[model samples]
Target: MLQRGGAHHRRPRAIERLVGAAKPTASIRALNFASNEMLFLQTCDIPSDITSTEALGWIGFDNTTAAEIFERYIARPDPTINPADLLQYVYGHISRLLTSNLRNLPRVQAMRVVGLNKPIRRALLDPCYDQILWTQDLHFWVKDTLKINYATLMQLQQQLGNYIHQRRSKQKQKPASVHGMSVVPPPAAELRHWQPEHTATVNMIPEDHNLPASHVTVSASPPTIREGHLMLYKGRAATESINQDGPIADDGSISMEVLSTCPGGDFNWTSPAQYWTPEKDVAEQFRRWAEQRCPYSETWLLAIQLSPEFARGLKREELWFSRDWKEYAWYCKKTKQPLSKFNHFWNDPPAGADLMEGHICTGVTTAISRMKVEEIQDRIDEDHVLQVGENETKAKQCVFLSAGAINRLGREMRGKLHIDIYAAIQSQEFSEGLEAIALK
Candidate 1:
């Protein structure tokens, strides 16, 4: 984490802002619910080039100076670097870019990345790049950029959720926030000790740690500072103030009582393909949850949070030499099989796996769409995984679950499976499961 010794320092010297024209055009398609194409596709569906960092051989900036980005990003011979080591390397690389390069200063400032696997300390940091757009500004940005009036709908949904919470007794409802799960302030219950609460409350919080593990988009809501600011949230000062003369006119753009949602992290920046899994799949979880809860509601507005790390595992070798497109994980079948030439684009089975029709394709199996609930919930699936060197039974479950939701839900995910992920630190469920996440 970025060390803060004492008082806040003066804002760093202002540098020339990065022009949009200077940066390469982002190829990712914008979200459009009205368009049949947008609604039909999955959020995790990604182009190999966009998700693959190796796809960019070099970045030529608008700067007249001839220094290209990622020059030092040489391929390492060792592919077996552990997660911790890999994280450290990435951290060091980003740090070096911020300190050493002038062209990168703009992106570095906009990102406001404090440290590897750490929350951003926005309030303390100098407003060095205020002109640039940050993640939190997406609500307004989407309206202006896409020429779509989504901001109005989003605000309405927030109001609707708030109304629901207020009308329903605390005994019956969750204190819902339209913001990403992690962005909500940590409750008094979590700040103190163990206590029995509603199962919903228990299901709300992040993982066991006191700190929020999910990425949160801070909002305009006023924050109580005496509670202790961990430099996690985006203070109201940073948010774009919305001037509502009254509740916005009902455009009926979203016909149903808009039930808006937000997961954590920057899904716009990454694909959620990492969450696909054979077990505890987000698709299965959602299918079961929806089926059991509100089978009447044909449509659900789902918000899934995609971490920055989600789609970043693509290596140079994977893009060019190797065909393994799946995220490496303990339970993923692709990780267990030997690294052989398997075409992920095609339906060809990997070497050695029995080619039963719609059965085990080994490295690349799309059979997740037809996975039975028993098969997904079964603990026996965990036993089958090939544990090579590591004996650890757990890793980040949310990441795997996100990928699983997409893989299992596929095109149906956009319409049904809303994968809103928050940091374990941010999620009540991830933190204190069945605890006090629902508490106001």
Candidate 2:
């Protein structure tokens, strides 16, 4: 009776084995995605050398300069560096380029806003850089320079696939490394404490602990501070300012102490600390400091400290949107830094369109929503633009939502929203929408 039972089970056991063998593993899926990306890249007419001055003008880089910069970084190294580390280094390098008044310039500021990753102040002395770089401006730069955007995307994906495959392959050989499991452990919920209110939206914010994680547009928005007499001062000034003017006395000047008088030895500047005042004299002083690349004075630091308060005191229209200000605010909030260190990027017109959104979090949304390609939610997918709706300026504009806001809207709203990213990419609209608004 036992032998007969065993004989009857053989066919079913064979069918089960075949089904299990046919299933794709994580590594296999990654490679398949990477292959498709590589194919798409091969079809593009990527320039080896671009000589068009018109194209070069958009990013402030000449053809030769752009090509050199692109080539220097585009190629894979003999010994590959981790993708995460490379991305971090690139971000820091670009951040260094924004010195002095450059951060306040609309074009540069726009680029910063478009770049992914919120800035975290590492310390007082260390140069603050965001952890990664993901910006549509970079795509424009690559397209203008005639470099391979596709390669970068594919390389990252390929390396990730290899990593996963290697780990999976070694499960039996190195059981100790795997902690005796047949597969690697799932990613830790880094956002567990900070998840959105909705249980369904818990996975909405993609997080992968596994992988390590541009631009040439010259569109000029209005400057945050108009050309005027800027007073640099120490001590307290009324945080409130009327009209477009900051806190200023009747003569358009304010008193501020000298940087040398400050308690900190870290700053080397000896000039009178600048205050947030308007006057030709103060403006000239700012110009001089910016040109000289002088260390920020105590009053300047005070100005930064009080900028948020001053902005809050102003009417909605009086406040100007600045990329640095928003980024700084988000960073301070994330780190639990005091309000004195925070600066806000207020929408001058008091509109949602002007502000950028923060990444989803369980704790809180720090910034406004930004529109990027839906594929950016996960880098594995091929990047392509979606068709803008009849009245919409950009494609799939509804997905970027704050956790709190989405929860309040209720869960039923979730089923109503559908993003057909793959379908969008496959459609003819992808090529037609090259000039679509960049992901903020």
Candidate 3:
């Protein structure tokens, strides 16, 4: 017992001797100060309540000293000190500094000092072993599987929230609104840049709702899947080939497995598909239902059915609803006239091909789809290719843009710009707007 007590007493004395003997070199001073700080912390058991400045001030340690201490902790000076214990001490000091009311913390300066002209390999052997200790509020820095003590992390989160609230309260007070005065303009009539035409709202009905009383005995022969037509299957975004001619059932229901449809294009195939008997003579009702669900354009359906309502409020708002490529191509094929009809520039012959031979563009054509040449190899037809007279060997979708409209699509799609539909009307002389004055 006496030997153990003597050893404990001699430990702090050895650290004091190291500190007294340490030269003015930054690394040596840092090593000595760290030893002293660690010994003090272990003896006092004040990791929770002690402030970073208080600990540093106890031995008059500077930012360089703090940085040196951090480096030694990370380097893991094995046999001399425990890496885990030292890491815990470092975490405590930095965390206290971060959550403290100090106007400026030396934590960043200390990090910068250590990182200056230092190669990463010199500090750490394995990148995975490189640990970052962050307070819970800075969740991006904190990993999903936390390495810190759960109780300590929770306490840090509370501290951070309290600090933030106090800072915000001191910075500014909430403004009070005047009676009968509009603080902001009303919402615009047209859809804003952020708003999408359609979104799934959560007015959920039972998944298994009873069929209408009048439609009790209802059935129909399964429709044949059309060729060269886009079929919007549930759970998939990219187009894939489906069985055009499959075996039919005697009961009028389809047998093929189809994934359930949802708001997003993603399909989950884990759940088994089920057959549902169609309501007899309800083509008009189905059309109305389809219109209500996807109002921008007409949607053709096959065997699959949509639920009565989406279970959750799913807000999937895209600039355009990506239908099956076939459906999109088919729609374009039907509604659009050929680009050649509008402009003679589109009818120009290939630069290398015989001018006397002319080009396929002179021939009557209707719609064109943006299909890559390699994608449609050997199957060169109107739907597969357009006579742009350019080399289509490049690994990109080929399109004949005769007009070459300004390409602002990339920047606009990034969501930086917003349409101010009300601003235009508000600026006109016919509009009257009010400005506010502060109350005495």
Candidate 4:
């Protein structure tokens, strides 16, 4: 033990405690530097200078991030980590950190969380994983199954919470917001004469509450198994098909297994073959619901729910809701797609023709749902798929929009402009609002 340097801090409690923990040993091996963080260590500017490699004692390290964090940490040569001892380091280091500030600890009984069943993978990257970690679901599962103490679980949660917040902050800092018609700016040549009609690009997506970004419905949700190209479960006759009765884009039998109606599910929410008619009882019900939720038109539902960004739009209160294909088809014309695939431009649009009437001018009608969004949240999991119903064999009649379909539409909508409700309003205030926003 060689003690060469000396330090004198006027307020030296923190530094003394950290550097002077051992009475006999001079060269310290491993030490908890939480005190130094909370109160700067007066002993030295750099804390790493106070530790010895042999004393840093190898501990088990479990990485929440798949490779970015776990691999990167382990890969680094400075802090050599042994794979066998990684998990130990994770538990010990996190536990130590949790104890730094406990002035007003909860008076509740101490409950301890033993550990996760599996190594946390894709901590921040995977939505399904994030949901489990953030919610009490995973903690309770670990507690019930492993009988981990409740107190321990709380600390674990705090640790995860702090870590997640840190990652999100870093993520937010790196990406600058993109604002314009296009989600990203076009090349320099195109920018030379950028016009309002030119799609602007925005880098940041508003935080989505209706559907969590991580809850990837496409990857996580069960696939709809199909037997043939044309779906056999064409509940409606060929004549009663969509107004266009266009060529069937897909002809395949849906896997009857995954199509189960939610238990106690209201049949009224079932998909309608055509657009809503105000005279219809269902339409009136929607009207009343809309009348209560927003100050503006309820018929907006018909307009808003058509885009691939329907989920995002809904959460942001951006799109109008549509009840049937008519309103949905009408709204798509506003989107900036070459084919207006969401509208008539697609060869197989539900409506028979292309909507020359671009985005609906403001003061247009919208629909409101009798059901609250919370109700939908209760019925569907983060994956945006309805929970497996009591009867697995029976296929669900119709969904407002299935996970697969939404993913497909979104994939199609990427880089394509749909009508922007916000811009359309400005145009509506003036005559020839449509031409003003259009590409010359």
lDDT of each: 0.22, 0.22, 0.22, 0.23
- Tens-digit lDDT track of model 1 for 6-105: 1112211210111122221111111211121111111111112211222121111122111122222334454466323222333344344323332234
lDDT of 2 at 94: 47
lDDT per residue, candidate 2, 1-440, as tens digits?
Answer: 00000001122232233233321110101111112111111112112122222222222334454344444445536425634333323334345333544434444343443331111111111211011112112222222112112222222222333434454465533422322223331222221112111111000000111110100111112113324312222221111111112222223222122111221111101111111222223322333222121111001112111233333332321111233323332333223332332222221223211222222111111111222223223321112221122442211111111222222222211111111111111112332333253342
lDDT of 3 by residue, 1-440 (tens): 00000001123332343333222111111111112221111111112212232222222234565456545555665736563643354445444333333213343343333222122112221222211111011211121111212222223222323323443354443321223322221122211111121111111011101111111111122323334321111111111112222112232222232212111111111111111112222222223222222111112222222222320111211111122232323223323332332222122222110101111111011122233323322333333221221353211111122111101211111111111001111112111221122221
Better TM-score candidate (2, 3): 2
Candidate 3 runs further than 4 Å off: 1-84, 99-110, 113-440
Off by over 4 Å in 1: 1-275, 281-410, 418-440
Give candidate 2 misplaced runs (Cα > 4 Å).
Answer: 1-43, 46-62, 70-89, 108-152, 155-419, 422-427, 430-440
lDDT of 4: 0.23
Question: Model 1: how large is the Cα RMSD against the reference?
Answer: 24.0
Write down the lDDT that model 2 would get: 0.22
TM-score of 2: 0.22
Candidate 4 residue 293 Cα shift, in angstroms, is 4.1
The worst-scoring run of ten residues by lDDT in candidate 3 lies at: 1-10
For every candidate structure, what is the RMSD over all alpha carbons to the true structure, in angstroms? 24.0, 24.8, 32.7, 27.2
Clashes, model 1: 35
